[model samples]
Target: MKGIHQSSMAVRSFVVMACVVIILAGIKTASPIVVPFVLSAFLAVICNPVITLMCRYKLPKWLAIILLMGFIVLMSLWLTSLVGSSINEFSKQMPVYRAQLVEQFAWILDKLQQFNIHISRQKVLEYFDPGMALSMTTNMLSGVGNVMANLFLIILTIVFMLLESNDLSKKAHLALDDPEMRLKQIDRFLQSVNQYMMIKTLVSIATAIIVGIGLSIIGVDYALLWAVIAFLFNYIPNIGSIIAAIPAVLLAFVQFGPAAAGVTAGLYLGTNMVMGNVIEPKFMGRGLGLSTLVVFLSLIFWGWLLGSVGMLLSVPLTMVVKIGLESSQSGMWLAILLADNVDDKLSDSSMENHKQDDTEQISEQEK
Candidate 1:
């Protein structure tokens, strides 16, 4: 009977894993539709606070949502225009930078030859491949088009989500056996996500503002453009800053030489160090933190699943998953494994307390 029970448990585990795999596969396959809705849901969460505040002032739900949605659309459109103009200006300037690039590469090759290393300018140019920038530009433009196309759908989703938010608790109460517990769990999860998003957004904005100021002072071309990119990519973890820095650094190098590039790098590094390493940890702590490996894996997985936008949303989406897992009995261990491990000390103390309680109970029963 014990063996049979073990076999049954094994089969259940297999079934659970299989279902997860199937669901993930479906999500990936349907990403064009799924990604937008998922993004809208997250946006709705971020915007819900504002909606609640407006409603508190006796604003109707419909008016509050309309105002919020209009604000979002206008901001998005303005940002899109800014990004578009930056790209256009960049394209116009690239040819002028090409000569500078060639000269810099030639000088580098000459220096390398001093160390008994030699490479042809043609080879270097081929490797650097100016044409690749144009390709990248095209791809970026295509991505923007996709975003514009989905703007309507995303807004619509947010509208519906906000409308449904009021009834969500009521629906949960009707659907669940333990409505109070479930509602509490959900409230906890939403609170965690909301706090994370709000903090992250503020940090990103502050970072971007600093970066923009630094870039403007440094006379970098498209300062606002790079700053905006930095803000967006800051949502991603680990390598996001590096990716965000690449184009700005490269442009700095081409336009102002290696010294300017170094300064730009320093600014990015310093800002990220202070904000990301210091300030962020004090607020986020272990409760919201994921393991470094988990963060990287989510970046890769979600980026693959939904492209660049997926990469941007990766950490938050993974956090939602982690929070969900942490709320479950059987999934708690897995969630702990993925966590940043800052909470382990607390868990250890709790375990010790449990053991002490068990010991006391045993002694009392024996007496």
Candidate 2:
């Protein structure tokens, strides 16, 4: 009987794994349709607080939404005008930059030879090609630009979502068997996501402003462009700052020589260190942290699943899954695995509490 029970559990696990794979496959197949909606949901969550605040002040919900949308539209237009023109100009200058980079490489090789370093110029160029880096940076920015083409659709969806936000809890109550308990879980999920996004967005904005000012002061070309990249990629966590710094540093090298490039790199490193290590942690606290491995894996997995936008949204998406898993009695083990700090004692205590609750409820029902 024990053997039979073990076999049944094994079959159940296999079935669950198969279902997950099937669902993931379907999501990947439908990513084009899904991506914008996901983006919209992200924006809606961010914008919800402002709407709530306005309504609290006795402003009509419709008016609040209109004002928020107007603000978003204006910002979008300004960004498009500024960053769009910069990208166009940068694309036009890529060949010139490539030429300058090649010359710089030759100069460095000659200096190295004088010092008896004897590094092969051909091998160096092949391995660390400036043109390849520049092209990669351009492609990444272009992918983001492509997503903006769907701005109208995303905004429209966000509008609808905000409208329905108030009724979501009511709908959950009607839909679930144990409405109060399920609603509490849902509320916890929303609260965690909202807090995470708000803190992250503020940090990103601060990083962008500092990066933009530093690059401008250093007289780097297209400082705003790199600053915008810094802002967008900051959402990614772990390696986002490094990726954002590459193009700017490379441009500094090609345009102003190695000294300026060092300064540019230092600027990014300092800003990220202060914001990421200091400010973010102080505000975010330990509860919201994901393991480093999980962060990197989510970047790859979501990027593959949904492309560039997925990479940007990867951490938050993973947070959603982690929170969902954490809420489930059966899935707590998986949540603990994803968490930055694994506390076995806390998990065991929580499990004991849950068991106690279940026992008391069962006894009450019997009585």
Candidate 3:
């Protein structure tokens, strides 16, 4: 009987794994539709607190939503105007930057030859093409712009989501067998996500402002554009800041020289050190409880699945999966595996606590 039970459990696990693979494949195929809706849901989550605050103060929810949407629309228009022009100007100047970068590369190759290093300039350029980097930078901006082009649809979805927020709890209660327990779990998940999103957004904005100001002071052309890039990429974990800095540093090198590039790199290094390493952690506390390897792997996996937006949303998405797993009695082991520091003892303790709570509830019902 024990062997039969074990075999049945193995079959169940295999079935679950197969289902997960199928779901992931479906999501990948439907990413174009899925990405925007997911983005909208996150934005709505960010905006919900303000609407809640206004409603608490006796303001109508509709009025609060209108005010919030109006503010967002105005800010979006203002930023689009500035960033749009910067992107255009940068596009115009790309050829000039490309030429300068090529010359700089040739000069380095010649110096290498002077030191008895006979690296072929053509091979170096072929492998690490300046034009390729520049084009990639432009493509990154273009991808963001394309998303913005669908701003109307995204905003409309957000509005609908906000309007439906109050009804969600009601619907969940009606649908779930154990409404109270499930609602508590759902609330915990939402709260965790909301706090992370808010703190991360604030940090990203601060980072962007600092980068913009520093680059402008250093006389970098398209400082605003680079700032926007920094802001967007800051959402990506581990490698985002490094990727954001590359184009800016390269431009600094081409525009001025290695000295200016060094300064540019230093500015990024200092900002990330203070903000990412210091301030963010102070406020973020233990963070999303994800292991470092899990975070990095999620970045790559989600980026591959959903493209640029996926990379931006990877950590949050993983957190959702982790928290969901944690809420399940059978899935707590997987959650522990995904967690940064959690262990089997903690998982066992958690399960014991749940069992004790159930016993207490049963006694109350009997009484």
Candidate 4:
């Protein structure tokens, strides 16, 4: 009977994974409309606590929401303006960028021809396209018509999220007749989402600042652009830091050749090692604790589902799903998603009590 139950569980797991794959496949078709709303919902989840705190200060509900929403809108506008100016500068210099790219690729093409390789450069371009990779963020800037729509959708979605957040909890309770179960799931989901967002944002900020300073010192072109890229990609676990290094390294090489490139790579690598390895772990304290393989796989899965934003949000999204699954009878699924032998950190209160006991014991021993 135990073996049969295990088999059933395995089947269920396979089915769930398969469904996720199918849903992601469909996202490519529906992403224009879907991405914004999904992004907004996640934003709202993370912001809900802040909104609630405002109410504690006796602010009117509508006023609090408006205040929060206004801040978001202004911030978004500023970000967009920065991006637009950077893009304009980039546009003016596209000829230089393009000429350099061709020069770089030509070196590879020359080496291939010297070896009597039958592969043409065009063939290589066709097979292993760089457009998607080169863009890094999205296909929007590549003369694609969707950039405006995407920007608009994201803004509208954020507004909707801010507006609907107050009613969200009540709606969830109403949706699920079992108030206790609904609340439990909602609580777990919110906790995981909030923790993920809070920690990830801090990590991103740290990476951006460090990378920006390093790049600016090294005289890399558009240091802020690279910093923005680093900040955005910092959301992706494990592999993202490496991916963010590429553009910087490229720019460094184009500007100051191989030595500068080496330093650029080293700086980014050192920043990631210190933060991802040392600092983030201290604050995270084994929460989430997703396996290395699961982290990479989730990156691919979510990236496919939602593009660059998906890759950024992948871990939190997975954490939310894992918490939701675990909140019911499927705690094992959460166990499966996380690292084996992950130590659950004791709460501060518990740790403080233990420290007090230790002090008392030490005093008695001295006596």
TM agreement with the true structure for every prediction: 0.84, 0.89, 0.88, 0.70
Pairing residues by index, what is the TM-score of model 4?
0.70
Query: Which regions of candidate 2 fall more than 4 Å away from where they truly are?
Result: 115-131, 169-177, 182-185, 287-289, 344-366
Candidate 2, 339-362: lDDT as tens digits: 787775366547768987998999
Tens digits of per-residue lDDT, candidate 1, 280-350, equal 87886654567788889999998887777677778888877876675556886777777777477357536
TM-score of 1: 0.84
The alpha-carbon RMSD values of the candidates against the true structure, listed in the order shown, are: 4.6, 2.8, 2.9, 8.8
Q: Candidate 4 lDDT, tens digit per residue, 1-367?
A: 9999999999998999999779767877888667666776777766777778999999987787778877876865675667667756765765575456556567777888898976665564444332334466434222112333465566566667766776766765665454644345465556656777888788899899999999999998778877877887788777778877876787676556568989999999899999888988888776565677877888898777777667767887777666555444455446444543444322432464687699889999999
Question: Alpha-carbon error at 241 in model 3, in Å?
Answer: 0.9
Error (Å) of candidate 3 at residue 3 is 4.6
Alpha-carbon lDDT, every model: 0.79, 0.83, 0.83, 0.70
TM-score of 3: 0.88
- Among these predictions, the greatest TM-score belongs to 2
C-alpha-based local distance difference test score of model 3: 0.83
Off-target runs (Cα >4 Å) in candidate 4 are 1-29, 53-58, 94-133, 137-178, 181-186, 328-367
Pairs with steric clashes in candidate 1: none
